[model samples]
Target: MKSKSNKSICKICGSDFARSGMTRHIKSCLGKHFKAKTKGKAKRLYYLHIYAFYNPDYFLHILISENARLEDLDNFLRDIWVECCGHMSSFMRPGQHQEIGMKNKINEIFEPGLTFSYMYDFGDTTELSIKNIEIFNGAIKSKKKIQLISRNSPPLVACDECNKNMAEIICAQCQWDGTGWLCKKCAKNHECGDEMFLPVVNSPRTGVCGYTGD
Candidate 1:
């Protein structure tokens, strides 16, 4: 009798696959057949992750993916900010060039830093669709959400010890003083249990640290 624990090989390909990557691996060899079979398949849903920058009432976004089309992303952003116009553009690789002003081909791919501009039509809904594509946003994720930050914008936070306005993270160890900006080294020192990190009311005016009612 055959044991229930015995493994079986795929009928399509004489290879053993526990799970996961098997289907994806088979795609390359059977890609043509798979594409042909799915020619009339229902459309697959995709999400467009977009970042927009606004100033002087102008708006631009770095189109991150083609999974959704240029129009879809514009609609999403319009919902987020209703008073702006939208435009869309495609970027080519470092060594590539595109026509000065012309519609992109259906097979054209977008690259990082490729700019897209659109006029916000003051519409309540915006949507579009495109082929599957990928976007690389470089290695800095912390600054990802600061798309709207500008030189003239107000400071996000005021460091009580340093008395300086800071838009980003403040070192938990140092007092908010100019020197308290404590370079990254000093920042690490605090993380290591430096004395400055001890519980103390250093900034009474700012009320950064304190007891219940005093």
Candidate 2:
């Protein structure tokens, strides 16, 4: 009986069968072509940021798709930094080359948005290959520190009367004590009082008359 399935026969091989049989046969017959079209020929375009120099020298590459092999990365890097051929290194996308296994080859076919990288340890020149590879962002980020400059600790002046202690008091009449070191009563009497006593200029007296200039 006719299976009446959609698969009729292998068009290329010319074998007769049902619709399902024909479909399966066709797939088997063109397995290589399908694999090539889907895996090898298929390409995806992507953008890659390359850090070439020991410093932060970034180069941008736009491609229709990534090549499966890392060798492609080596060639691309060499072209970018022609001056440094063998010095450059290569890494793949999605994972850092250094972190991944070394034996992995880069020339394999790649899917879209795939990424790769190359580096130079600043070594001798040689025709570059997919050797030791490492990948890192060109810039490293860290928190910033703020520094405060103190105001010279406001010049600790000694007390004029009690030279043993720090002084912030100033004798108004003489202006000798810029910091105003006199006691509360002395400051009031010297500056506010009309009975100004000889301008508090003379050496500080031990008694009230001397300190307050009474």
Candidate 3:
């Protein structure tokens, strides 16, 4: 399916930016000045590239301290994309039955090129494929356990009916048919009614129950 614009708004600065440029922009942006930094010695950090298993183009790049726990990453994912109601989550190596706990330090198990899976909400779960892309020693900028680097530009999706204007809503009932995307005007008269429609969001979790994105 065709997607929407890849642009994203910086929550801190309210600046508009393309996905590819966000990482560099965020690093030196004035917004960073307000966030608290780690006061002690520098430590090794891991940079991860996380993406939706089914929609690989929808992704995020992030940095975390080596000592940060799996739970830290889980909370980051929840805050940024998938949290709605309190939900259970888990991480495990693909094809393995053993689950990794939130308390486990990232460096204890993660390494370059390693791939893992994350599942949120046992029912109607959102699955993510995570890869340890790079590792390096660096100074952490904020007291927060996770740092955003960049993310995939939102996909540009055209209205399925008008096939001209951008899609602004998706019909929950018709989403699986791939004919659910609609422009705002089309959405009003849709057979599914306004209640069945959800806002088009920059997330793989879009259309899932109660997820509106951060």
- Say which candidate scores most in lDDT: 3
The reply for model 3, stretches above 4 Å from the true place, is 4-40
Clashes of each: 19, 28, 8
Give candidate 3's whole-model lDDT. Answer: 0.78
lDDT of 2 by residue, 16-90 (tens): 544224323434544433234443333332223333233221122222122223444445444434322234343
Error of 2 at 89 (Å): 3.0
Instruction: Estimate, for each residue in 1-214, the C-alpha lDDT of model 1 and write its tens digit.
Output: 0101122233334554432333333333233332345443223222122222222212121222224444444344434433222333332233434322233321243432343333332232222112222332222113232121111112123333344433122333344343343333334544534444422121111112211112
lDDT of 3 by residue, 62-125 (tens): 8788999998899899988789787898999867858997899999979888899999899989
Model 2 alpha-carbon drift over 4 Å, by segment? 1-42, 53-57, 82-85, 92-117, 121-214
| Candidate 1 TM-score, C-alpha based | 0.23
Best of the candidates, TM-score:
3
At residue 75, give the lDDT of candidate 3.
88
Q: Each candidate: what lDDT?
A: 0.29, 0.32, 0.78
Q: What is the TM-score of each candidate against the true structure?
A: 0.23, 0.26, 0.82
**Candidates 2 and 3 compared by lDDT, better number:** 3
